[model samples]
Structures are given as structure tokens and as C-alpha cells.
Target: MPKVRIVDIEDRRFRVFSSPTVPGGREFVLVHGIGISHRLFSRLHRVLSAKHTVHTLDLPGFGGMPRPDSDPDIADMARDLAEVLERLGIGPVVAVGDSMGTQWVVELGAQRPDLVTHVVAIGPVADARHRTLFAQAAALGLDSLREPPSANARVLVEYARCGPRWYGRQVRHMIDYPLEQRAAELVPPLLVMRGGRDPIAGPEWSRAVARCAPRSRFVEVPGQPHLVQHTAPRPVAEAIEWFLAEVPQ
Candidate 1:
């Protein structure tokens, strides 16, 4: 896992993780949620890395990197990701995102359709029905109750490392991102997935995302929680693989 430094136009350096690409194999890029880095997707990455080229990106300010002088919104972060992939010469890869990371991928797909072949959003955030901060917090709390102790412990550590002040700022951007509206503009295929037991991203919200998009699908990983990628990597990976094979041309 080599760390690739991506310097944005503002000269902010973002360290991203990259895996070696296999000849004639599918390409995948995994984006993690706010307050956590690529570490959360370690299990999922390993499962996919066996057969596909997987790149795990750690946006600036997360995963031990220095925070930018100013916070960047979802669109800005999406452009940074596109620039990084462009510099690396990677093209039209499947982008998988978790939680708030989903918003970034949606923005990326809408902004750079040429760079992304498809997008998979797992446990996406800011459900329209529960748009308020308090409602989102309540849903997260409910999901936390369903998640395993180990998963909760990991999140606690990651959140502490992220620091309350910085994490709060990022959450504001996340909750404010208009995911459904942006989803409508995505040219690439979109797949919105939610864990059966995930309260953060319910079935209704996931389906709404699919409905808004021109080419999209919605799936559910049963008996999984908010951290399905960590707890149910096989199922999540299988779903993504199936979607990739069925993506519209």
C-alpha cells in the first residue's frame, strides 16, 4: 500500500493509499466516510484486492494527514479526487464509497463522468426524511446500538483521532450536501446499498437515490449494520461485483 501524495490546487497535500493493478482485472477505488480513514474498509479492500485492483483513498485531514488551511466542501473534495486519479492515469474505475463518502462519490460522478464508470454508495448519509442534524444523530445512535462492540470501539478511536472540532466541521459539510439532487445528474451507473439493520441509511432513502438517478439500483445486505463493509465484506464485495457486471453501458 504505497501512499500517493495528491496536492490540490490550493497546494494542500492529501495522502491516498493505492494497490497494484492486475492486468485485465477490474479497477476499484474505495472512499471512506468522514472522521474515519481507509482503515475502516481494510476487510473489504482485502476481499476485493484478491481479484481486482483496489485503491483506498484517505482524504486530507483524515488518517494522520494534516488538515487543510480551510475546509473544503463535498464538491471541492470530489474535484481533488478526480485530479488525483487523473495524475495517476487511472480511468473509468468503479468507485465505492461508505457513509459520508457516498456524497463525495456522487459529486465526483456528476462532475467527472469520464473518470468514473460506476459508483456504489454503502450506508449513505443525509436521508431526506431525516435531514436535520438531530434526526441524523438519532439515526446514527440507533445504528450504533445495532453495530458490534468492536465496530463501535473502532469508530470511537477514529473519531477521537479526528478530533471533535474538525469532525464537527466535516459533518456540517456532509449533512449539507444535496445528494439526491446531485444523484440526478450522474451519468455513470449508481448503486445505493444499505445494511438491513442500518438506521443511518434506510431502505426508503436508498431507493430514493436510485429513483433520482437515470441509471441506478438499490440493494440491501441483510443482518448487517452501519459498518457492513467491515462486518460483512464478502456480501458487500459480492453485491458490488454483481452490480459492476450488470452496469448499463
Candidate 2:
């Protein structure tokens, strides 16, 4: 079993689940969305770790980590992640993010392109169609109808652990982040993915995000919901592998 390692970055600390690096294999870093931890990517980690080194991160205030004095915005989180990667001496890895995780990945790609070779954002969040809290909630409610029971159970558990106050603060930061603008600044090869039936990140939003980056492609997992990475880990992993193969190292 992979154990958690605490990494200090200035005043803040992060909990990391790191696997040993494989010889001649690429390093992959997984980032989870708001109010959730690396647990969300356990299946994906298991699949990828077979052939490559995988590092799943639990940013501050999530995954049982102590909350900071105030909630850090998406860019703040990205900056801290960039610093963490630099201190860890891992570079040129494919950074994979899900939901609100996309904002962190995009900002990192823009801020520290040297650290990330390729980017994969699954079910990226805050579609322009639903900008406000109510609208986003509505979309989430609609999509919840399509998600699997296991996914719902896991989400509930994670949310309860996150608590209402912290989760609400994180949501505000997530929805307020200028994802598209920062995505356009990404220097790494970017791949945008979402579930075909995902109400939050629908076709239009996914296409728009893809267009933000010059070298980007949009792919969808058919018949899946917002938590497609969990529901269809194989396909998502396959897509990421294909993208990694195509991207120049």
C-alpha cells in the first residue's frame, strides 16, 4: 500500500502519495478537485503505477490536512504545487487533474511549464453557461442523477470529511478562477476530457477549454457522468497514455 508523506512548502504542508519511479518510465502526478483528496484517483493510480511512477497529491485543507488561515484560491494552490514539485525535484511529468483540479493544472502549466510536459484535465469545471453558485449547483444536481452509486458514496464521504465551511470556500475559489484565460497561457501539450453526459462540463465547455490551448485535443467518455474517471478508469487511463505517447518528451 502507498503511504502518505508530508511535504513542507513554506508555511503550508501537503500530503503526498508517491510511488517509486520506474526505470525509463514517465513520472505522472495526479491532482484531485476541490473538497476531495488523492483517494479519488486510487483506481487511476493503480492502473498507471503498473508502468510508470505516480504521485497523487492532497493539497492543504483536504485529505485530512490542516486548513490554512484562509482558503487559498486556485492560483495560490497552483503556485504551492509548483513549489512542491520543484522541491521534490520531479520534472517534465504529465500532470493529470479532474474537475476543479483542472484549474490548478492549467495554472501550473502556465506558471511552471518546465515542470509539466503534458496536461490532462478530466471533467474540468465551471462552464460559462453556469457561472453562479446556484447554476453550478443545478448542473451538479442534474449530473448526480447519472453518476453511479459507488461514485456517489465516495463523494459523500469525501464531502463530509471536507465539511461545509471549507467546501464552500473552496467552491467560491473554484468558480471564480479564470480557467479559460489561464488555460490559454498553457505551454505544455494540453488534453481536455469530460464525460459525454457530464452536465457540469458539457461539450461546449470542453471544446472551449480545448481551444484555449494551441496544441490541445478534446475527448469524451461516452455515457459516463461527471465522475467519469472513477466510473471508466480504463478508458481515461488509455486516453492519457495515448496523449502521453503523442506528446514530445
Candidate 3:
């Protein structure tokens, strides 16, 4: 089994997951959304790690990495992640992201084209119009974190990985960054997947993105929400596999 490697850049350190596969076949560097750790894809990682080298990193200000000193934008994070991929000798590898993470992958495609091969945006949040709605909805969902109809304490701990300050800065950055332009810069053959019930980046936004990236395709997983990767890992992985399978080696 390929274990996690901790990479230190200057004063910051990030976590990465490597696969058992030698030669790192079809590397997938997964950048998680705001305030989340690579563990979010624990199930998918365990499965994919068996084949391609699956590298998942903790963005600064989220997970085990130290909080970023400034209100960093997605581009900055993408560039930083690009360096990580380079150090791992992982590209032109496929880049997979969800929500905020997905947006970052778009930025990566725009700024560091050489690093990303196929792009997978799952439950992508391409703008503020959708984010404000989702944030409000997440706040409301937090209110019901009790039992039966509420989220558990453990998930709450996972949610806290973003930390109040980090999460706040992320929301601020998301508002300032112009994602529509970035979404349009995709290099083509982009795979966009959104959960049917994901309020943050619903079907409408997914379709919009598909239209924006003329070479893109969209898929909606039924009964899933913004965390489609978690709610339905198998299908998400399958979608990615299908997309990568078609990519010219």
C-alpha cells in the first residue's frame, strides 16, 4: 500500500497519498474543497490506490496543514498544488476536485496547464451566486446537528477542519475570484459531475459549466448532494475512470 507523504514547502506542510502502483499509473492529484482534509475521499482513495497513484493534499488553512497567513485565492492554491504535483513527479496527471476544490482545479488548468491532464469537477461551485445560497443552506443544516434529523458530533469535528478564520477567508476569496472566466479556460475533455440534490453547485450550474467548457460533459448522480464524492464514491470513481480511460496516453 502506498502511504501518505508529508511535503514541506517553506513553513507549510501538506499531506499527499501515493498508490501502491509502481510507475504511478494515471496519477490523480485530488484537491479538496475549502476546510476539508484528504480524508474526505478515504473510501475512494482506498479503492483507487490499488491502481493509479492517488495523491490527495490538504490545502493550507485546512486539515493538517497550517492556516494560510493571507486570504489566498484559488489560483494561488492551484499554483502551490502544481508545485506539489511536480515534486511528486505526478503529471501530466488528472486533477479531481469537489466544490471549492473543483474550482481550484479549474484555476490549475488555467494557470498550470502542464500539470493537469484530464480535469474532473464534481459538484463544482463556479460562482458566488451559488455559493451564497449553499453557505446559507450549510448554516441551516448546522442548526439541525442533533440526532436522527441532525449531523453527528464526529462530522462536526470534520467540518471544523476549515476552522472559523480559514473558512471565513475562503468565503471572502471565493467572492472576489472570478470563476466564470476560469471555467471557460479549461483545456477541454473536462468531466463535470454534480449531485442531483447538491444545492451549492446544482444541475443548473453544472450544465452552465458544461456549456462554458464546450469540450466538457456533465453527469448528475441521483439522490446525492454537494458531497457527492462521499455520498457516492463508487460512481464518482467510475466516472473518473471512464473519463481517464478515454484520454490519449
The estimated TM-scores of all candidates read 0.94, 0.96, 0.87
lDDT by residue (tens digit), candidate 3, 8-50: 6665567887766646467777878766677676777776766
Candidate 1 is scored at a TM of 0.94
Q: Is candidate 2 or candidate 3 better by lDDT?
A: 2
- What lDDT tens digits, residue by residue, belong to model 2 across residues 19-84? 877888888889998878888898899888988889999888787887777667888888899888
Query: Candidate 2 — which pairs collide?
Result: none
**What would the C-alpha RMSD of candidate 3 be, to one decimal place?**
3.1
Sort order, TM-score high to low? 2, 1, 3
Order by lDDT, highest first: 2, 1, 3
Q: What is the C-alpha lDDT of each candidate?
A: 0.86, 0.86, 0.71
Superior by lDDT: candidate 1 or candidate 3: 1
Per residue, candidate 1 scores C-alpha lDDT tens digits across 62-157 of 876677778889989999889888887776788889999999999998999988999899988888767787897898889889988978888888
User: What's model 3's lDDT at 249?
Assistant: 30
* Highest-lDDT candidate: 2
Positional deviation of residue 199's Cα in model 2 after best superposition, in angstroms: 0.7
